[model samples]
Target: MEETGYTVGRMRPEWGKGGAQSLTFVVTEDCNLRCKYCYVTHKSKGKVLNLETAKKFIDYLLTSPDIHQSDSAVLDFIGGEPLLEAKLIEDICDYFKIRAYEEGSRWYWKYRINISTNGVNYDSDEVQHLIQKNSGKISIGITIDGTKEKHDLQRVFPDGSGSYDTIHKNLKLWMSQFDASTKVTFASEDLKYLKESILHLWDEGIYNVSANVVYENVWREGDDKIFEEQLKELADYIVEHDLYNKEYCTLFLDHIGAPYEKEDFNNTSCGAGKMLAISPDGNIYPCMRYYDYSLNHQPGYIIGNLEDGIDFDKARVFLLAMYKYQCDDECLSCPIAKGCEFCQGFSYDESDSGTNFQKAKYICKMHKARVRANNYYFAKLYHKTGIKRQNFHWKKELLFVLDDQYASFCSYHNEKISDQRMDIELVKEGLKFAEENFMKPVFLHSEQIADEYLTDYEEVEVLHRIPIQAYREDLPFYDYQIIVDDTSIDLLDKIPFQSNIIFNLSYENISKLSDMMEVVWRKTDRINLNLSNLSKTSDLSEYQRQLEKCAYKINEIEKHTGMLKELNVLTDIMFIKEHEGCPAGEDSVTLASDGHFYVCPAFYSNHLPSIGDLKTGIKIPNEELYRKDHMPLCEKCTSYQCENCKFINKRCTNEVNVSPAFQCKKAQIEEKTAMKLQKLLEGRYEFTNIISAKEFEDPIDMVLDGKMMRGYF
Candidate 1:
């Protein structure tokens, strides 16, 4: 049976407000150069858009309600070297300018025209005039592969002569005339020269630069090694020059910085459905990439024409398919699934009517590699600077218990601290150490607040763990947290809805608490479900099944009530929000009742060895084990949503960073389930696909498998 999985709620698409805010005009299909890796099949056909066609394209774009209401719109003129038709581009710019000033309306509406061109025609007087006249409104992006040697390698003239010198001279002239935002788009497969190329550009005073590896070509093992080496060298250069803090190196810094979430992941491609591309022949496609000379005449590729405007029905289907298209099950479950880009145009089959999903594998590998590299770079930088990355942090609070009179306090701690009062002297020393280390102290108690000890400290969270039947009295003096279990499930109805509570549940009792969800719901819509006391002997499979059942029950209730309820299940993996695994000791340390400091409360409860004691100060032994990137498997695994509890790892595998098989399997199941639910509710719900379940193994592994077929494994 195909399991659709339980939905948390309706996962609707965020069809953004307004119509097309950007349009790309493919001005021409003619170029003087014949690049080796060019995807265009008819670059030599010399099909260019006349001034009449340009006007028609602009008129079609202005018809959009989104454009009419907007303050500004982007008009991009793209290749086959858009500069080849510089006069037509200038005329188009003048037309918009005249409309903006002559007409008493804001129809032109602060329009910005962008020209993407090779530097070959940038030195022309017509192009210079366009740049000079519309200085602020027009931005030019010139392609210069790198240095002269690198640029001449692939980007040569049709007559087999190097155009690097001409391009270089023209780019210099273009940069002098254009005061607007100018960027150099460089591309090269020569890994050895990649950094040198970037440095060369910087040396030439071109700071705003972006470079990319030619994606259409195959990358060999040697090439991969070279790329890694080049990236490391580039990173070293960036750090040495303090470029990490500068905007000039944004392209490089972006890769190592926080990942961007510009679009909803449910939509497969970027700007495809939203942005229209008008080809030279007057046919409209989703984006410029979809405008294949041979394929643009087809049904699925072309969304509309200049004569009739957009074909809404065909456009809807294309957009929906782009949103619904998943490469495979692995892609749906991967941790960085939301960051993955899928373009049907990239994998479109000329011979067939639809896209070829198989080609996505190559692109997926490259993306994963880039993600890995970025994470690796960030991790290194974080450890060196004591700075935090997107999902990883270095600072956390130490929760120390002043009183342990509750029935649920760990028996190990209870037995160790029997009849022992709070050690005021040790706590004072611990507090001083915490202050020195910038660690917040969380005081947990079963009774009244320790006012005398906590008076001097203003930044403390006091958690009161009380039995459900206990009498309600005055609110605690500090920021309070209530800790409860399944026994207190019914009593929650009496508690205020705004109270922050942690509902503790053992793996075995999750299903039994399902009946009490109504009370749980009434108490707080966002309650944290803590799975307490998990060990190697625990039956995780049963726990998983119970959790799934619970999710279904809650979802059913939500469906009837039309109210969304969020359950933070072990299987609910949010990749973008929770990019790092459990902080454990890296961010936080726990000062236990026994006057000893451990990695976390779980470590103390489990009777694990303490890292240090109050008198000696906090000293974590083998601290590297708690770092997120320390484990090879964890670093490579795309399931970034896992709690990555070191205590659980030690209990299950006798290794801190090594995840138990059951834990990994359970997480994978949850990720897959979430993805399935998201896919089912794509058009209706506004949820991002953080990770996909699509399986992506290394491409080399497949090659190895073929070799192993002959007994090489």
Candidate 2:
């Protein structure tokens, strides 16, 4: 079960020093019925919490300095049926009410007391009084399995009679008395029952419903198909009823267009570290699920008892274990890793006597299927509404620089012409296409240009590359971009202060460019560094060193001149928020000098096949090859900040969709470095709160064990 290359460990959650603000009390273990899927093994034990024990727990919480600093607190009561001990709950509420009035107005104004009930005793006078007393401060969540027929089949009375009638009556009364929270918790292999149950609840005006599949039960053939069909129907029903517009329709649909960040991808879901649950006997556990299992006395399970207070050392150990828990390799690489609901409780329940990883495989199929269902559900809604996915369009602010014949030749391939000059006719056609597409085109030329060629396109900006030996008098139009290399570093002072300039740095001359940072900074604020000659074998350390040097120099200049000199690599990550990657043929298609259309300038430079000719228009042969979705590894990746350059992918792996190890590593390092630099300049600069960075391990290597090299077919 060990994923090769990945070091299996738990991930700790970021929580406040005081620990969990919410506390659950397993008020009683006594039960009035026998449910088929009950997790509590000792429901008939009849153990219950008295007023004295409940008071002790509350006093401990309020006395703790770290825990008491918050203006709010949640006191949750869970049991075989918490309503069975209605007097205890009433007394607890009274105590809190008196405390608030005695202490101050805000003392208990924000405090909430909630209970999860089976709704069997909700019609009782005592329970009704409790609800009326704490109108807004107290909330109750009643669990209904749906229609009477389906609910009675699984949940029944002690004598085996149906309890649905009693529960249903109580639910309606509770709903009318107070605007309480309600949900239908159902689990069954029968598709008809499951479907009918949901529809029944919705028909009864129970829109805030939730359901779960029985993880312990094995799903047979056709089960998945049934679930998927039901999901589709549910989605349609939601749309038809306009439930999506309602704030209380608890089924979350907001993740539809939300892009996941790095923290979202690589994190655990367990609340063990932050939450504490106390049993009826006053022993403390991580959560209600862990407490209900009756394993509080077991080593690593219990934190401490009410008499001793919380064992901070044991709690820390438990939290650490949960934080370090990693799932199987498949789960690690899953596209919906951020949305996974697997927790340490499920792991503990499913683990075998001797192993820790076996349980993950059992639930893998269900988890993946559910993720797909959610994706499909959202996709269908967006399609029906004509809403597009985020970041699907090419960046509007980016300028596409189309290089001509002289600049198209690759330095490495001196004998071969990687690109040729576009004929004047083809250039005119391309310009027409660009204008029609609303693209900002910047024609890049190394040789001299004629006035007639420039007269036709006065609106378009022309970037002229000047050789080191060229005199400043020979420079082209004043407002155009000036392209220079290491050889032209000294001549930067002569360039117009308002003119945009790009300093191209190759591997051979990066050191030279690094030496002229002071001069480059003093010359102008509008300068971009274009790092070229990157390959699989490129020196990452050297590149990193140069970037660090540039960052240091920029900081120095900002300090002296009181003006920030932006380092493209460091500053770009802060603003280019979402993963825009390389937009090859999507927004700005390149028309090569040879009268053919390629995905971009990189395609022509790499000698890849042209997508189409100017006469035929742009028809991508295999459009998915250049799409982010088509890149299996990249789509699942949390490195959403990566450049995702298609040219780099193809050059290193000989495939447009497949990313090289070096490229992924480099992008991650750059993102991490940018985050570090961001912290340093936080208050100094008003950077837009766009990009967020987190420590990321390469999932492909960690999970696939290098098997991804065989291609994600």
Candidate 3:
């Protein structure tokens, strides 16, 4: 006998990693019993996936290029009770394995036959034989809700007799043969059994229990409080028994309860679009949930058929367009929306309109209650273990433009009219000023300076060297950053440091940025993308498109390579929750070659009036105007990741605080694009905050329309 590869004590399913392709077979719609909370509205012996239908679907699935793209496959079997068709399932599994080997498919060895049964027929000798035959390649979960009382409440027969006695008899045998796990579902009627049922499952040696409250709109007014209290009770029981690490329950995860970065929250909860399901009639859906048997009002959404293959348009609706329908502005912008769950199929079925996009939020209150309980569990666990969460600190830095040659298109500087170089003495004086003002000093230079000269100003914390080709091994600076322009985009390979490279692209080269976005993530993490010259000719729509492409590129790299690199323009907006825009005069000031201090290097390069010279302490005539509070439109805005450059503000709006329509539109583009990116990367990373989708496009328009109050005039 082989070991069966089953862990005796613990079994946890991998969530959201996205490698395997799931193909579900509705083995038969017939069952021995009808559970009250079952999603399948119609069940009959006539609707069975016959041998011919199963073989045809399996052959098509194994031979299809789109289906074979996954490294592995999961052949999921489900029905009113899949075990009723145990022989058909066995034959299907055998054909799938043999066909996969015949075609030399990767799934020949990397496939799982997963059957979810209602446990009445689980003890059948035929089902037992099938399990033994494919012991190594199969996983069969027997759905037992927990304590006999709880299980009997909903899982009853046609005669209204409880089937718990029959299921309990096989638990010992089931646990002995497999790493047992069960699916526990709770509806409003069974709320009180939630805590004891979980503990009962654990006591019965079923350590891993995947559980959830129903997602339908059946939740009562005060059911959330009961759900929360039950979970807290379960938490106390697990903690008291020292079973936090040993037992598994989906409701009490450390990652839930808290708000995540907006981008990190999942767009859709279930694997609807990705997972394929075949009905007995040879029709295919994105998942079993989309089948007519599972839905309430709407007809089955068929994405493909055995003869015609997949309809990409229907599939795209599930994969790409479904998310837009599944959430509204309120749900998308919710602070604690990270772990909230929604079923796309259910949303489509329950939608008032015949649209597939509108999400049905019946589980919103339940999710909130779950989040609160999850928080309590973690707080208790951390208090017991004496662990603390880490906090983030934002530091300010001063930019010293070494010379005018390197000043073109610096993140702040729009243009360079002078080529005057800052002497070694002026550099040291600027560093001294930075040290006195409690700001980190950064040196920006166009040409490489002598090693001896770099050694002179050791106070320079970071040297942002322009043109990636300028780097050399003998350079004294070991931990400096690089800034790449359009001229140096191809020269990104010349960069020696992989960590701190910034690709500074201006608005004029937006198309070029899109062209090279595929290769940029391989070199740098941050992109200081901004509009150096926001002219009337600039099309806001085109910029939005390009910026969105860059955002998608970041998500693609993370999805394929599992390497998460940052792209500042879009990613920054996702992480920013408040208005923490550019800190020009407040925290950082620039020292020009002429020994004059300006708000930033852009003011110096463009020959704007200086705040003060190096001879006297820095002093701005009206410093309050540089702050966000003075700018009414900016103050009301939430695009905090935007730089909100004061130089551009003064150039376009003729005020330091007020932003022009161009600036506001660009910020809005980045902010909206960030929300899209967040949706793209939802399952890949766990974010703690959100880059919420704003209701308006441009904040300036909001002010003009009298929707928002005016700021400093």
Judging by lDDT against the true structure, name the best candidate: 3
Which of the two, 1 or 2, has more lDDT? 2
lDDT score, candidate 3, position 149 = 91
Residue 437 in candidate 1, Cα distance off native in Å = 32
Q: Tell me the tens digit of each residue's lDDT in model 3 across 1-713.
A: 11222111123556224568898999888888888888888888789898899899988887877663578888899887889889999999999988989999888988888888878877789999999999888888889999889999999998999999999898888888888989999999999999999988988998889898888778888999999899878766665665766777777654453344435434566788788899899998988988998888998889999999998877887655434446787776554565677777888899898566787888888887876566555444433433221221113466777777663444454455555778888877776666444355667767555343555242223445555666765665454666666667777776653765566666677777666655766666555554565664678787788878777777777887887668676776666566767788876688877888889877877778888877787898799887666778877788877777787778777888887776777778888888888888887767655767677877866666663546653
Model 3's alpha-carbon lDDT is: 0.74
Candidate 1 per-residue C-alpha lDDT over 349-393 given as tens digits, one digit per residue, 9 for 90 to 100: 332446533225454444544444444444344333433234322
In candidate 3, what residue range of length 10 has the lowest lDDT sum? 1-10
The order of the candidates by TM-score, greatest first, is 3, 2, 1
lDDT of 2 at 289: 63
lDDT of 1 at 191: 58
RMSD of 1: 16.2
Query: How high is the lDDT of residue 378 in model 1?
Result: 43
Query: If the candidates were sorted by their lDDT against the true structure, best first, what order would they fall in?
Result: 3, 2, 1
| Highest-scoring model, TM-score | 3
Question: How much is 390 displaced in model 3, in angstroms?
Answer: 9.8
